[model samples]
Target: MTDHVDVLIVGAGLSGIGAAYRLQTMCKGKTYTILESRSASGGTWDLFRYPGIRSDSDMYTLSYPFKPWTHGNAIADGEDIRRYIHETAHENKIDQHIRFGHRVTRASWSSEEALWTIEATNDERPVVITASFLFLCSGYYNYDAGFTPEFPGLEDFQGEVVHPQFWTDDVDYDDKEVVVIGSGATAITLIPSMADRTKHLTMLQRSPSYIISLPQDDPIASFLRKVLPLGLAHRLTRRKNAALAIGFYVFAQRFPRLASRLLIGAARKRLPDDLDPRHLTPDYNPWDQRLCIVPNSDLFRTIRHGKASIVTDHVAQFTKTGIDLESGDHLPADLVITATGLQVVAFGQIEMDVDGEKVDPHEKYVYKGMMFSGLPNFAWCVGYTNASWTLRADLTMQYVCRLINHMDANGYAFGMPDPTGAEGESAPLLNLQSGYIKRVAGMLPQQGSNSPWTIRQNWFLDSRDSRRADLDEAMVWTVRKPVAVAG
Candidate 1:
């Protein structure tokens, strides 16, 4: 069956749900539909069912700006986040507009008609939809599989090996010796949560990551909730948390050495006095990679109590019982967890084409980090790396709404970022050094050296620009240029 709408949103996750709400409130009478690939809502939050899965960033900024997170915990668990998204969608009647089990495979835009023909499959059957505007809220990661490196002798391992992305509750690990590989946020979270149930938990890493401990319950937030109105308290806490995160990021960038020393020093104070500092000291400077946050010093407390251990060494090979280290050391385990990283996929695995020409993301330049240069009526939400993801997602949706309204006011059918006169040096989309980002850098879009084209990682700057920026100067909206007739 064929469907049509004024706006078509991809993915029913956090960003998509938020986008629906914004469109409903801001652009009234604009019919829209949300195409969700999975059978349910809450894209990433619902996908991963691993133990101890929670947000590394604080919930104050991670949650939607309109919806105040009433939950007491600043660092909320995956279940709570899922529930929040579901509640928001249901309350706003956004869930009713969602078409679950529809995985969009390809989208072709017709410049003359000024519409996008989206093709997808629902329950192995073909489905098609057309829309005037396409808002891609689908996340950047590959949902099919997480990034797992090829390990030598992995096939010979007798114990169960698992990746957190595909984890299930039935895969029992109770009273088993667990060895978690990698030192990212996922590994750190899993270590503490599994430490109690396992015979012993060992966090095996090639190197250390910068880990910080913060209180789970913010005293200021708790007090504000008691005295002030709920909405005011939520906004205040969100601003405070956003400022603290931005301040730390700016400090780290400006004074890498000093920031590194202070961060390492703080981490050292949390661990046992007799423990060697090398395990906590990262070779790289602060902010080079995302910092690992453990709410209320839970990871350190577990280590100090001898429920878990951290080992830094290179893996030589995977044995039948465990892993063999290159430095003549071996770790025996009954279950191994590879918390390696994610596989980044731009545009949610959908192939995009304009006027029958396939769009190569790497070749195209990004416009304001959301819209692709020369791509009309298309925008995707990519969050900031330095701050909370929702902070940028919220701004992105607002900007898209403004653009749509601007087009309507001007009586235009198409809007595209045409960079003709202003051109300068271009750089990679993200400035991060994480394994997942580095792996897919070549396939991602590039940003220009100047404003409107450059991808801003700062929330303060992006939020300001998203609200008041003039679109006519940067974006071109008009009738499609007629195709020249062949001689």
Candidate 2:
């Protein structure tokens, strides 16, 4: 027997939950079931557990409009963020709709039946679910595993190798020498916290990242969160922070070299005298890959205090004793934590097909950076690539509600993106690229050649078009039924 639902949401991440919440509240009398691949909620927060794993963007803008975050630091730690997600699920009463450990492997559209056939497995037991609408909320982050480099002589390594995602409670670096790999946010976050316990910490990277320093705590943000109620505080903070982020994103995009140089200059001032600027510099501009945010230069302060060191060189190989650098040096480590980035898996690696034909998503244009081409009754909650994810995701959620209300008024069952089959149009709202965003750029929806749905990556535009704009024929995917027979 197959269970019937109005909407089948995949992956219980921020986006997935957001979609579910919107549908639950707005879609009167519609039944929706959310399938989470994992046994728990909190998607990325539930997945990654390495030391100091946290949000790079400020918490105010990173959180949803319906849900708010209260933390001393605007950039929250993983634990705090996780707590917020759990609380939101519980408070919103959305937990009952989610089935844990139910991984959706494949879904096919049955046009004849006007339903989606979703095949999912929980603990190796397969279950069939049917739904009228399919919302792919599974975020772009890899849920399967992380990328760990195959160093030479790995079998002979004496120390333990740890990954951030599967990190356990037992990884105590207390008085031990720890070496963390990768220059991404994970590594930068791990350094300070790990340094507090480890005798010494070493950050190993082949090339340096464009790292910027923000306050460990935002005074205004923290105060606002305390002074006002959650809803108002979150809204005000989101607007204020969004304006700042948009200004920075615009400046960086318009003046790439100048922005890069200014960031490089800021980084240079925080390093030791012996460090070479070029060795620690990057070939791409800031946010080209992703810029790392630090808590009041904690990583820099630790490096200056001699508790940690940043080594710039390629990893040649690994020995039984330690890691061998291309510079002909070996750094002995008691514990090696691989802060290596996650292996990105789009839509949880699920295959989508319509009546036995495979849907090559990359070839299709994203309608508004969420839904696919000509696939009505479906909406996705994918976020922006340039700025904070929730900035775009929150907007997408709001848009979904607006669309749902419009469809409900017209007595419609579905709404899909109109197919124009445009080229290079589906590319990201941002010109820059990251591993995950790059892979799915053309595969997602297109906004326009430029903002809201085009190249305008501004949160304000997303707010206006997605939330407040008129959805009159131009910006919405809508469907309605024919007039019924008169009495």
**C-alpha TM-scores of all predictions:** 0.97, 0.90
Tens-place lDDT digits, model 1, residues 1-487: 6789999999999999999999999999999999999999998899988998999899999999899998989999999999999999999999999999999999999987899999999999999999999999988999999999999999989999999999988877899999999999999999999888999999998889998899997889899999999999999999999999999999999999999899889878878898777787888888889988999999989999999988989889999999999989999989999999999988888999999999888877888878888788999899888889999999889889988988888788898998452387878788788888999988998888888788777888777877778888687778545579999
Best by TM-score: 1
Clashes of 1: 0
Best by lDDT: 1
Residue 8 in model 1: lDDT: 98
Candidate 2's TM-score: 0.90
Q: Model 1 — TM-score against the truth?
A: 0.97
Kindly give the stretch of ten consecutive residues in candidate 1 with the minimal lDDT sum. Answer: 419-428
